[model samples]
Target chain A: MKLKRTIRQVFAIAKTDFLGIVRNKTAIFFTLLFPLFFLIIIGFTFGTQGTGETSRIQVGTVNLDGNMIDVNGTVSQNSTIGDVFVQVLKDANFTVYEYDVYGDKDTNGTAAYDISRGEIKIAVVLPANFTETLSYQYTDSLGIPIPTRAHLDLYTDPSDPTGSIIGQQSLLGFISGFIKYYQEIAINQLPENLQDYAEVLADPITVSTSEADVSGRQLRWIDYMVPGTLGLVLLWSGLNHASVAIATERTKGTFQRMVIAPVSSITVLAGKFISSLAIVYISAVIMLASGLLLFQVNLYWNVPAIILAIFLGALSAIGIGLIISSIAKNEEAANSIAVLISVPLQFFIGAFFPLDIMPEPAQIFGEALPFTKLVYAMQDIMTKNLPFEAVMPEIIYLTISGLILFVVGIIAYRLSLKRL
Target chain B: MNLNDIEIDAVTKRFEDTVAVDNVSMKVAKGELFGLLGPNGAGKSTLTKMLCGMVNPTSGTIKVGGYNIRDNAMKVKELLGVVPQDIVLYDYMNARENLAFFGKLYGLSGGKLRDRIEELLKFTQLDEKAVKRHISTYSGGMKRRVNIAAALLHEPQVMLLDEPNAGLDPGNRLALWEIIQTLHKEGKTIVLTTHMMDEAEELSDQVAIMDKGKIIALGSPRQLIKKVKMENTITVVPNKITPKLMEAVKKISGVKRSYRAYDEEEKIETIKIITERAEDILPEVVSGISSVGSKILSVQLSRGTLEDVFILLTGRSLREEEQL
Candidate 1:
């Protein structure tokens, strides 16, 4: 009978609190719409395509090649190799811009300026002697012919890290293709006996590449970010909301009423926890649904693991929130403090970025956060499609840390009750 | 000889260097309507909180419903209903919803909870439309009514109402008094704390006047007034009250006690002279003020009451202390 009463009391409080949130417009905005707003903004910005057709990468070209050719021993304009190279780049799905079209005289300076202004991802400068070098042929003392090599200068924007890598790789692939075409022509011009030696000399070594099988599905940036976004949603709904629950009640004079009731303080805290957990789950679900529908983020749906990770993550966040609530003097103060802590914590926990790219100290700190553990576990289950046992370490860490912090939160709540 | 419903012995509560309830001892018998009257910050609410287990006494014991609060807090809590000074109901919920929520916390459920909610809403005299509207939209009096209704959900034996009529208008205050009297008639022991002396005198079976965390006087209203041997009080409003005029008023032969107070609303100073007979002192008191060159605006005589009792014990008017 006693346990039954306690359960009833917890549910009663939870029901009332949940109803209070639903009725309050400000609460509804923060609890449901705010996180979805964030997901929409981020999803559209990064998750535009996944293994499908993509927009062309913008490239700026400063073609200074004179187009000089050794035709019958007279150097005149015959074949324009620079124009051919530019056409090659455009054929490879690059939106190429020539320096002369922009009326720029200095080649290197024009390329650097365009890259800085974000007008182009990368710049290619074909040197003035490019064709001349390719046309030059020499004979050693043994009377053997050799072709001169030409160098193409490629400049990538460092600020745009991902775009720079893709731009450089694409440019290099096209350049290799251009060289092979010229190599075949040169070799065909030689005698049949020298053709075999020239073909071997042209390409002595090669590299073969294949992608490692991770999930057997092509993943996009949005796929990697979906779990992190869910963690972020949980942080706001769980920690930010819970931090103000007790303080708001105290300000409204309801905390004293609850304290004077037959219910224990722990029971009241448990009720608040249940309410916060429900909100966290609701926000997480809405965020995931939005991601799936809007961005078409392809992720493994491990329902049980996802549920467990969210529960543990929300538990830890609410534990921290309770501690803040106990220390805050009023609802406004609690809200300010929660935001001050949560804003920086999102970055530190790798919710917006990856920990591996962060500094070592930051990586260490991020790896220790409970939300980071949740993100990691989610990534493994969703992005990598790992089995349940693969995320056990993260699950264990969250369980232990969540339980410890929650116990401390209860102690703080009890102390606050005494102060009241 | 009724059994005591509440017993507080040597209870003291301190915050830092200030003592809120200092060595206070009192007993409230079952079915008794007890009033704790004092100025603001006079420790009445602190003592009431101690009785309901919302606050712990620093150095003593409190027992409610025959259970020691320190040892069996939950048991004591189960037997008492607390109506805090502030309106504590959720603003977004209507009367029925708020009552149902609190009812469940006290272990009521199903048909019982529903029936009690309906009964309380009607008993509080709320109209059907008012009952259905959200508490945020209700008038102050309606909100106070619901605040009291929430406390009575479990029908506990003891109810603690701390300044329930603090901000109510006179009409609403009278309505609240009627509700409280009805509750008392049903044999529920109640402890009401207020700084309004008339409110204490009009409603209490017994009144305890507190000051500086101590109960200076305790008795029924008539008994306390008679115990102090107070007689009629003559109040004289003067155009200007100077120190010399106050001294002359006090020197009158029939004057037992004299104090000057400012009427905030009237924007005038008044001298109150407590005496065995107001008629005997009225002529001399007016002449005394006139001799000091202070013009007398008006004069009135009234019988002694609880405010007189508080003035006799503390030499300060309850209303004056509250203003200060």
Candidate 2:
């Protein structure tokens, strides 16, 4: 009979409490929507960076192509095809800027010629000796020239010149490649009777590779965030439900009524604790399944074990919630305290960033928190391909934290009962 | 005192710096509907809370059905059903649901829980609306009834009710009387405290009128009423032969206390006398009226009542205390 009464009381309290939770839309939002919001923010922004894939960098490219000029009725036999330069500038992270260069036309209706101004570096100039220099096999600035050579003038700019080093290096590299290839074409074209001062050796073995270009399949940001997002959902639901149980019921006087009932103080606290756990896990699972379906979160290597970790993580989360509920006198205080606890912990625990890049102390501080261990366990399970044995410490910590919180919550609730 | 009776032995409750229930004691019989009547701040709730084991008495022993409270806390809780003075209940659940929930808490289940809920609902007249409606929709009186129904779920051997009639209408108050009477008939020990004199007079087989945390008068309703000196009451009409007439009425024997009319009418007055009988008192009063050359306006003898008894004991009516 006593057991029957207890069961009936539990059900009675559970039903009313469940209905109360459903009626409160704000709780549902905190439990369900808030984590998704954070996930969207974290996955696209920090998640990509934390998991070793850098976000795309925007590089501005300025490709200057030169045109030929006629000087004193003699026209230069060099002109640059601008379309080819544009094509070269349009590679990854490249925003192309095309400009006209005028340097070797100082005598052709040009008042002044100054390539010293840093408007464009590494400009292509079609010099009057361009074709002649290429045919005679002369090298300019450590290069062998071919016929109809594209005269590339390399300039190093000082002001507004952050990328000057890379710009000059790439420009010189391209010139070297062009010059080397032109030597192959120009030198062979030269008569065999005429011997060149520079002897060309073409027996260099070309080592080719198509083996490890694994760059095309970039890392998806969703992998790291999916676990953190799930942890957040559990955190919010657990904390909100635990804190709201007392305040909302007290506001309605239902708590007062229950206290007057035959139910013990511990029973009331346990009932609330159980309800908080239920909300946390349910919110977690829903968020998990939806996170997987919506964001395609990685679930590899004993998915059941990952699920168990999340459940246990949720237990600790609810324990934290109990601690919050025990300390806070009302809903507003509880909410503020929960946010203060949960938000900063997310940063420390690798929810917003990975623990590795941070200093060793920060990582230690993070790993000490249950969430750090949980995220590590979750990420390792989902992304790192770690087996369950590696994650036992996290499981143990979460279990210990949960038990401590349960005991503390009971003690605090009983103390409050005494005061009442 | 019967060992099986509920005995409150010199209980005093101290809260922080204040003493709430100061050295108070009373004994209730096995089947008596005992009432503790006092104004607000009279430590009625404190006493009852101590009895129900919600709050511990600072210095006292409470024994119910031969079970000492300090030694047998759980046993006392199991045997006692308390209807708190405040309306305490889960507002989301319906009447029947609330009753069944509390009934189950007391160890009733299966058909027994359902039966008790149904019985309480029908008796409380909440059966007609038991289906699917939430308790928050109920009126104050209905909610009070549900609060009561929750208490009776365990069918306690001893029942304690505090201010159970506060929100009920007169009709419902009378109905509450019937319920208490029936409970008394079943010989369930009851300790109820209220400021409602009429309720105290109507239902209780014995009454304890408390003041400042102490019981000043304790007796049956008739016995308390009989303690007053007057049997026949006299009323003097307020008239213009006034000062002389007031003096003349004072000169007349048997007149004890005089006052303006109970209702503040200009021409009517009231006086009470402690006469051995109205038969002998009426003749002298009628003759005094004729002899004084002022015509006998009105003279009648009225019976003493518990309200007067309260007045005799406390020098104020129950409602007067409420007004204060």
Q: Which structure among the candidates has the greatest TM-score?
A: 1
- lDDT per residue as tens, model 2, B1-324: 464568889999899888888888888888789988888877887788788777888998999778888888767778888887777776666777677767756667788788888788876776575545777787777777778778888888899988988877778777777777888899888888898777788888899887767777788877776766655555554333455655666566766543333423343545444454667656776666566677755566667655566666666655556667
Question: Over the stretch B81-189, how does candidate 1's per-residue lDDT look in tens digits?
Answer: 9888889999999999899889988999999999889889988788998888999999999999899999999999999999999789889999999999999999999
Looking at candidate 2 chain B, the ten consecutive residues that score lowest on lDDT are B258-267
Which residue pairs clash in candidate 1?
Answer: none
Q: Return the interface RMSD of the candidates, in order shown, one decimal each.
A: 0.9, 2.6
Q: A206, model 1: CA deviation in Å?
A: 2.5
lDDT per residue for candidate 2 within A119-167, as digits (tens), equals: 3443443344444444553434556443344454444545535345545
Off by over 4 Å in 1: A49-56, A66-79, A101-116, A135-204, B264-268
Quality class of the docking in candidate 2, CAPRI style: acceptable
